[model samples]
Target: MSERTRYEANVCVLLHRAGRWLLAVRSPGVAYAPGQVGLIGGHVEPVVGPDVFETTARREVAEETGLDLAGVDLHYLSSELYLGDAGQPVLTVTYMGELADGIEPRVAAPDELSAVGWWSLAELSTVENCAPWVPPLIADAERLLRRR
Candidate 1:
């Protein structure tokens, strides 16, 4: 018998403001990436409704950060594959957007996140215990920023 390959579609938002990006610390109790810093995102819930990747990105950001992206212009950043906590393959679509002036993120989902804050590229690179993909994502984000 062969093992079945499982896959999941997820969307993440790299919320930027004043040269900083918003990041969330996953709660220890969470199933994926527990206690690691990562972008605001989650698996697309097809049961609730079918949505475009951008809508899923926006929804996940709001659900995790309490920040409204109603008027914000989100740009497609990049996409990559990684293993989930359960070791299932995950395809993640990433979007970048600038938050409204003076807006900040809070822990909207305590059960999912332990903390939320803004981090600069340097900080992101040097920070210990960040999600393994985060450093490379930061580089991608920097390239995207340079293109703008």
Candidate 2:
């Protein structure tokens, strides 16, 4: 049999403000996790050169949530492999960071996201239609936040 396709690299940002985490509602037309609450992020573009994971995370957060992570300290949270909607393997790198003071999230990319909101850990866990990766990522983010 032919070799399996290489896994796509993606990055996710768990943006925290006060005691809440930022989550986006995926656009209904999106290929992965459509209509579900999920972290703000997207695929790492190959053309972006080295250190693209963090670059992509920053870009995606701005694109999807209209928030700037410029001076925020992004702490690496975790990484995992999961299948995308197209049945391709994706290696997702997750990062956690605090939202800069006085900034609020809005749905910046209407085609990619429908809404943006901040949720506490308990609130996030109670969301019924969240993406599968959300729960674990939230737990990881909680630990990271605690140490801050």
Candidate 3:
């Protein structure tokens, strides 16, 4: 890795309702993490100025899931920095918020996602069904929620 290598930044937000969490299946063409059940998020683009992270979270969540997160305050859960499968540094900031009582996520970006569904928290005990990075963030959300 070059000392001057720039890391790509992405935001991931988890929404939980009725003991199930929202996730999407990546279509086989994305540059990273394709074809795995992963969070509802995307890269942090520079359009949203001061609140870059939060804005990116809102945009990605809406664009990818068709869920209008307007006024849904996102709380930070965790972050991880590591080399992607392509050996480039990727930084993912994880956030969590409750899925509103009656609202649900749908597949809004057909090209980027193949399907969208909720996964049982219990079913996620094993990592086979999701990206390797998912479990820890979910654990962090659970831990923090427990403390509330």
Candidate 4:
């Protein structure tokens, strides 16, 4: 057999409540993009039962921020392929979710994130160290949200 490449599959979640984005600021200790404002998500776990992307989005949100997304509606925004720090091919899928009326987000994983809060795009623009890809994701999410 010929050689084949292996890629890591990851999922990212963007949550919005009344046109405000639920954003996370990564801690300075992370291996990738530390101290940046980015979406909340992680690698997809190997599970048999639920949708892997959705499951990962939910799990990551719960782990990174003390927020349960069980009741929120999740919409797939986009998928991207990029090179990781280790020169591995990485496939990242992004999901957009709308936060429930009364639900709130908190920084649950101190080691992974420094802060978690809701902000408007205008407000988010002023945040330092925001990820470069974050604006594109937000645009995609807003476009999708308008279709709903």
| Highest lDDT scorer | 4
Q: What is the C-alpha lDDT of each candidate?
A: 0.85, 0.85, 0.83, 0.87
Please count the clashing residue pairs in each candidate, in the order shown. Answer: 0, 0, 0, 0
- Tens digit per residue, CA lDDT, model 1, 52-120: 788888888888888778999998889888886778799989998888777878999999999999888
Candidate 4 lDDT? 0.87
* Leading candidate by TM-score: 4
lDDT of 3 at 147: 94
Model 4: per-residue lDDT, tens digit, 18-52?
Answer: 98999898998988788999989999877788588
Model 2: per-residue lDDT, tens digit, 43-86?
Answer: 88877587778889999988887777889888899999988778
TM-score of each: 0.86, 0.88, 0.87, 0.93
Error of 4 at 42 (Å): 0.7
> Clashing pairs in model 2?
none
Q: Which wins on TM-score, candidate 3 or candidate 4?
A: 4
**Sequence-dependent TM-score of model 2:** 0.88
Residue-level lDDT tens digits of model 3 in 57-145: 88898899899988787899888898887899999898888887878788899899988888876677764758876777777788888
Assess the local accuracy of residue 43 in candidate 2 as a C-alpha lDDT between 0 and 100. Answer: 82
Error of 1 at 30 (Å): 0.9
- Backbone clashes counted, model 3: 0
Residue pairs of candidate 3 with colliding backbone atoms: none
